[model samples]
Target: MFPNQIGDFKHIINTELLKSGIYIVKIQNNTKTYSDKLIVIK
Candidate 1:
């Protein structure tokens, strides 16, 4: 898995190497934490 540390929370993912499945995204800050799930379709 790759982690991003950019100030702006924007990313470009190369789906070419990813298979269709369920993925989890977790984001955290000093005040709050967020989590989400993503479904990818090929």
Candidate 2:
């Protein structure tokens, strides 16, 4: 994950992303929060 000071950021989820399953992604910044569910198929 890359850190951002201007309320902006970027990330790449390619590492260890070969398995097929359900995954959860979460991000937080100050009083803001984010979450998502991802489904992967082989």
- lDDT (C-alpha, whole model) for all candidates: 0.47, 0.42
Error of 1 at 28 (Å): 0.5
RMSD of each: 6.0, 5.9
Worst 10 residues of 2 by lDDT: 3-12
Clashes within 3 Å, all models in order: 0, 0
Candidate 1's error at 31, in angstroms?
0.9
- Using lDDT as the measure, the top candidate is 1
Q: Write model 1 residue lDDT over 1-42, tens digit each, in one string.
A: 655644534333445424445344445555665545354644
Residue 15 in model 2: lDDT: 36
Quote the positional error of residue 3 for candidate 2 in Å: 11
lDDT of predicted model 1: 0.47
Cα displacement (angstroms), candidate 2, residue 12, comes to: 13
Tens digits of lDDT, candidate 2, 1-42: 333333552222333553434333344555665644354644
